[model samples]
Structures are given as C-alpha cells and as structure tokens.
Target: MGLSPVLWQFLVHWLHASALFPAEASGIAPYVDALYFFLVAMTIFGTTFVAILLLVFSVRYRREKNPVATQIEGSTLLEATWTIIPLAIFLVTFVWGALLYFRIYDPPTNAMNIYIVGKQWMWKAEHPGGQHEINALHVPTGKPIQLTMISQDVFHSFSIPDFRIKREVIPGRYSTVWFEATQVGTYHLFCTQYCGTQHSGMIGEVTVMTPGDYKKWLEQSNSGQSLAQNGERLFASMGCNSCHNGTAAARGPSLAGVYGSKLTLTDGRQILVDDAYLRNAILNPSEHVTAGFAPIMPTYQGQISEDGLIDLVEFIKNMQSNYRVQQTLVTATSGEAAPTTPSEGTTETVKP
Candidate 1:
C-alpha cells in the first residue's frame, strides 16, 4: 500500500530538504549524520538552558523590585560539571571523527586508480585501460575506486554531493579521494572551489554500475582496442620517434624511460619525470629548458587536441619499463646528420 497523504507529503519535504536522502548516502554518511545529531542536541540543550535561566533570573531579579542584583559566588561543583561534561563530549566526538577520517584517507589496497585532470571548465578522467571521459566519471559498483586528481590551470575542486567528498585540485600537485558505490546510478559532480568565471558551469556526473554492467560498459568505452596501441600508432604517425628514439642524434632529449624517473637538466636542476612533465615537454618545452638542451623543441600547443596529449602521455608511461632503444646504434646508422664531436650540440628540434 502507498503511504498516507500526510506521510507522503512529509517524505517529499524531507527528501527535498534533508541531506539524509538515500541517494546522498555514501562512505561519509554515517559520520556526517552523527555530527549533525550532535550539533542538534547541543543547540537544543543550549537554547533551553539559556531560555530557562533568563526567565528565572528575570522573575527573581526584576528591576521594579530590586535593581541591584545579588552577587552569587561561583561553585566548584558547577565548574567541574561543565568542564567534565564538555570534555567527555569532546572525547567522544574526537574518537568518532578520527575513525571516519582514517577511513576516508586510507583507500582499499585493491582500489582501482583513475587519473583526473581539471581544466578551466571541464573534467578529464582516464582509466588505466585508457578509457577516457570528459565531464563524466564511471566506476563499477561495489568496487573501491581512487581518483588521483590535479588541476591544469588555477585551483579547482573535485566534489561529489552523493559521496560527501570534496577535495581541492591544485596545480603542480596531486590530491586523491576514494569511494565505493553501493548502488548503480548517476550522481552529480560539481566544482565546489571558486576557480574562475566558468566555475559555476563546471559540472559533471559519476555513473556507478553493477560489475557485469561495468564490464560491458568498459568494453564499449574501449571499443575492443587498447589505449596504448592507439597511442603508439599516434606517436609514430606524429613522427615523435624521429627525435625521441634512443639511437637518434635528434635535437630533442631521448624519451626512453623518461616517465617515472628523475630528469636532470643541463643546468644543475632536476625535476621528476612524470606525465605532467612529459605533457609540458611536448606542449611547452621552453618552460623548463634542459641544461644542455637548446630551446629548439617546437610547441605542440594547438597542433594536438587534449585527448591526443593524453594518449601520447599514456604511451610514454607504458614505455617507462620496457623502452629499449639503443641510442648509440640509431645515431650511428641513421642517414640523418650526426654530431661530429662531444662539443657539438646533438639535440634535435622538431617543427610543430
């Protein structure tokens, strides 16, 4: 049977106004509920006590009867009671909040990692398998998922109302958040940080699916091809190997094992060789010119689309472990001009 009219109306109102709506429940829901209840109790107790005391005092010390109120000495018992009660309440809150904080920060060992990049007004997410989504995130239900996020431009925030998680996506630094969905549905994603003029419009969705459905969706998302394979093809087609190959006396630095390693510049400076650095080396090589390297590397700023850069980065990352180019052999055999002496510059420059 359906709910009574009054009950239905109440339910509708509660769903509209309450944060306890079923769809909004996620990992942090229980702790959030606890805090909400605690605050409500505190509010009730404070208002009631203050109101009763005011009424009693007003009656007992009315100005018409006696304008000068009697000075009451403070009681040790009153001080002890207030101090002990608040200390006990604070201890309870601290324990509860600490447990939830640990749960939120420590992700499951088996959690699948996804990379998310926040730009001016959009979110670009990529699964390890190379499945990419813009302004949308997809994860299988009942499986833990971790998002490693960074912002390409100004500061942004990755927030999911349903999950009760909000994290800032800072530039040049990484932040992570994790969640395991209990239900299969689409949830809203919002940039809670005021990034720029378009911050309000930076919205997206998170789609949770059953395991079986997730597999099917993954297949569809990948279209039966691997991202690395696609990326390799793109790399070769774009003539990246001409300069980045091991054997080439190409004007550009060799990209072999460049991912996930430390790159030392011609100057004394060193920087981590990561996806962001690789992308920057491709799109804006002049930003951090290698110590011995000339600023001859051309920028691919508009030549490649955002997705193309992601593919390229993925390809380079995959090559991190298995890249086996013989630099000396390529330089010696290639008909392209080779450097004659150690003093001669050997870096190759590619025209965008």
Candidate 2:
C-alpha cells in the first residue's frame, strides 16, 4: 500500500513537531484566547511606551543641548490618571475572566456526565452508558459534557489543552469541569500536576465524535449494562433502595430531584446537592443532616470504593433528570397547579 500525500505530510509534521499551540476544539477556547491576547497586547503596549519615553527624554533633555536640568514636581492629575487607568484595565480583565470561569465551571443541568478517576500514572474514564476507557475519553461534539473527577492517591490535574479546561483531582473529594466540544477531532489530554515517579507518562487523548457516530460507538461498546443500571443494582445490594425509593415510611430523604437542588440542612443552612455534597452525605451522613430527616442512614465510608461511590452519584444524577421530566408531563396532563407530592411517592425533605 502507498501512503497518500496528505498522510505523508501529517507524518512529517508529527516527526518534526515543535511546541505549537493546539487547536481550539472547545466552546470556551475562544474566550481563553481573548484573555491571552489581551495580556499580550497590554505587555507590548507598556514595553513600547516605556522604551519610547526613555529615548525621547534622553535626546530632548541631553546635557549637550541644555546644560541645566529643571526639576518639576509630579502632577497629581498624572498620578491619578496612571493609577485609575491601570486599575480600570485590571478590573475589566478580572470581570471578563471571572465570567468565563463561571461559565466553564457551572455545568448545564442537562450535560452528559462522565466519571474520571486519576491514579498515580493513568486516567480511567467511565461513560454513563457503561463504556470505559484507560487514558482516553470519547465524547460527542456539540453537547455539554461534565467530568466528575477524583484522585485515588495524591492530587492530580485533569487538563485538556484543546478544551481550555483544567481541574484538580483531589483524593477523597470530587471536582468537576465541563466543556462543549465545538470541533470533532482527537485532542491531547494530560495530567498537568506533578503526581509521582510516572508523572511525565500520565497523558491521554480525547476523541470528540459526531452525534450519529458517537451513538453508534456507544451501542457497539455496550458493556451489557449502563453505569446507572449497575448503580441501581448496587443501590439494592447496599440496602439504599429501602430508604431512597421515595416511600413515606423510609428513614432517609428521597433522592429524586435532589441532585442539583438546594436543600435546607438541619442547621438551617442551604447547600447545593452537587457531587461533593452527595459524596459527603454518603460517606458521612451525620455531618450535614437534612432538615426534617433523622440522621439514621449508615455511612458507607470504608464499605464502598471510589468507583462505587461515583456509580451511586451517577444514579442519583439520573434520577434528578427523570423526576423533572415526569413532573413536567404530570403538570401538562392535569391542567392544574403542579403537585407538591414527589413522583416517587416518597415524602422526601427536598424543597422543590
């Protein structure tokens, strides 16, 4: 077989690759580029202005031209002008970066989630559909995708250069980052944090595919059960369904619609039901007990592994979506006010 001209060119570039910037494959890349360019332009302007000022002053106020030097006090207007101008510029950039950070951090309610476990030297990814990969992630383009990541041993960082998103993977805690891939291609994924002896080798690739192709891939790579399905089975085996199934007599609060909503704690503090909160609630139930619910649920601290905890979290996340859809349909059919009762028949303590 003969290699095509395009393939030969790609191979040549790969062999002679330099430190070139990766392509902007994510929706947030443009915003990141904007901030980067802003900094570069400011640096150039400040350097050029200072250099020109020095040159002009040296020539105009030369000792050969004028023997005497005139000393003038600084102008308050000039000082204020310089201070306020720099402060305003800093404020503008600060606000712009803050907005972008929030947009990247706050995953959409409907984003497809993938769990990631960062070990000492490798990245393990698990799709909600049960497909698993080592050091590689396959996601569909043009859709919001959230990664709930945790480290097994030391702290690690999940970095995708092309996506402009990086998050710390802390042990015993969950951190999340999200992005919508705008381009369909393969991009580099790396652990930017210094882990251990194999830190340099902790690298991977992120493959973004089209919607149709991604669906096909999922169907083909079916693991005989989805993550949520496995979670449901684990829930039953762990005796979680007895309380979380939304029964009136259950001890624990109903989990339906509780994934992202805020719940009033027993101490009257409202907290969002995110990954970290859920993980804590599972491993430490007495710490942040929900209002009107007794702290009777047993902790699953040493009993469950990190991967198992993630599976349970994924199951709860799916329940939230299902609950919302069911509520919407019920409201449409009844033509009355939305029911206060939870669809799962449980008197869960969640407020909306």
Candidate 3:
C-alpha cells in the first residue's frame, strides 16, 4: 500500500476508536480549554508589547545620536494610567477565572465518589461498591464522578489531559478532583509531579462508558473479586488479625469501629480516625499513639510498602460496618477471650 493509504487507514482506526474533544469526552473540557487559551493569550500579548516597546525605544533613542535629547520628568498621570489599566485587566481575569474555578470545584450532588491512591509508579482506584482498578479509572459518561485522592508514598499528581483537570495527591492528606465525561472513550492519566526515579513510568487511562455499560462493568468488577478483597486476604496473611482481633485483649486496639470514630489522645485531644489516620498508624506507628495504648506497634514504614498500606486501610474500613456482627460472635462464642467492655478508668493521659 502507498504511504497515503496507510496513513488514511490509521486515521480511520483512531477516529472510530477514540473521542477527541471536550464534546466527545465531557462537557467541562471546552470551558477548561477556553480558560487556558485566555491566559496564554494574555501572557503572549503582554510579552509582545514589552518586547516591541524595548526594541523601538532602543533604535529611536540611540545614545550616540540622542546625546542632547531632553530629559522629561516622570508624570504622575502616566504612572496612574499604567497602574490602573493593569489592575483592571487583572481584576477582570480574576473574576472570570474564579467563576470557572468554582464550577470545577463544585461537584454535582449525585456524583459517585471514587477513592484514588497514588503510589510510586501506579494509580490504585476503588469505588464505594468495592470495585477496584489498577492504573485504570472507569467512569460513567454524562455522570459526574468525584475522586478523593491521597498519596501512599511521596507526593504525586493525578491529571487527565482531556479533562484539563489535575490535583496533587499529598501524603498524610486528602485531595479531591471531579469531572463528568461526556463521551465514551479512553483518555490518558499522568503524574505531573516528579515523584521519584519511576515518575515518567506513572501513567494510566480513564475509560468512560455509557450508563448501561458502566453498570455492567461495575457488576463485573465487583463480582466478589477485587483488590479490596485481596487486601483483606493480605491483612490476614500478615498476622494483623492477632493484634486487631475483636475478641482478644490484643496489644493494639481492636480494628473494629475504629474508622470514622473520634479517638482521644493521651493529652485529652481528640482526633478523628479517618482513612489517613489509619494509614499513618500502620506505616508510622510512632507518629500518633493511642491514649492508653503502649507504643508497641511496629513501624511498617518501608517494609509494608505503599500497596500494603492501601490494602490495610481498605481492610480496616471494610470491617467498620461488620464490627457489630463480629462483636456478638465474640461475646457468645469466645467469652473468655473477649473483653466485656472497654478498658475501665481509661482516662486520657499526656505523654511526658
């Protein structure tokens, strides 16, 4: 085949398999692109104007030829004019940009929440229903999806070029980004931050599908098989059950009912036991010790790895709702091992 024929065939294949523009993927893309263009135009205009003025003045007022030129005093009016003009321009840009920004930040009330954990060289995603994907994110077209992101290791960025949305996933904190995909296709996911040696290798894909197709995918993804489930298995494999068992007076507090509860510190300070806290407690046990609990928990710091933390957190959160079920079993079947109640006289104490 001729070169033109091969090129045409390639173009045809891409067109049939891909959705290119904002209209094809999501309605929000065009607005984001427009804002980007506006900023670019303003920067270009300002730079060009300054460059031209410098060139013109240099040639017209050459030092040798204009040695006797009149030295005019600065005018307050000219200074005021320049300052006011630039201020007005900035105000206008600020207002426009703010409007667009709020729109992006304010997610739809009905949007589904997906948890994203960014690690060294991969993106780990999980839906509320326990559907998990590695290095790939799937969302339903025409429905807004909010991603709650956090870094498992170092800082990383979750960016979708087609949606023109990106957010930094910082360690020890949660960051969120949301977008509604208008079309159904695969879009690129990149880590814009230079995380480590494998930063460039951190890439993924966002697959958008129709509502019906999304439901089907969700069902398949959650068919009793997922990373979240595997994480539970891994937790068991690591002997985490020994300390976290509900019925035992184990070294550490029971993992049951620990998530989303207010944990009182030794100094009478209260901290919410959210996902981030749970993860940190696992990776860096020395960071925050429970009020009455001894600092005997081993630091899984580098040994457990990033993926291990995600699995551990998922396992802990999953046990939250089912904790009561296990509590009853513990009391009835394992009365001797199970504590009848929480530690008595467990008043908060300050660390010296």
lDDT for each candidate structure: 0.74, 0.83, 0.75
Residue-level lDDT of model 2, residues 113-191, one tens digit each, is 8899999899999988889899999999999999989998999999998899999999999889999999989998999
Supply the global lDDT for candidate 3: 0.75
Model 3 lDDT per residue over 1-352, tens place: 1236677457545644675433335667767765665676678778988999999999999988798888789999999999998898799789988998898888776877788989888998887667878999999988889887888789999999778788899986777889988878899899999999999999998998999999999998874644455566566567665455554445567777787789987777899987678878887787788888777778776777555566677668768654435445445753435443333322323222
Candidate 1 lDDT, 245-315, residue by residue in tens: 55445655666677877877767789998666877888888788876667877788878755567678777
Better of 1 and 2 by lDDT: 2
Model 1 — which ten-residue stretch has the worst lDDT?
A: 321-330
- Residue 165 in model 1: shift from native, Å? 1.0
Q: Model 2 — TM-score against the truth?
A: 0.81
TM-score of each: 0.64, 0.81, 0.66
Query: Which residue ranges in model 2 land beyond 4 Å of their true spot?
Result: 1-19, 242-245, 320-352
Q: How should the candidates be ordered by TM-score, best one leading?
A: 2, 3, 1
- lDDT, residue 74, model 1: 91
Where in model 3 is the C-alpha error above 4 Å? 1-24, 44-71, 91-135, 148-157, 168-176, 191-203, 226-228, 246-251, 254-257, 303-305, 322-352
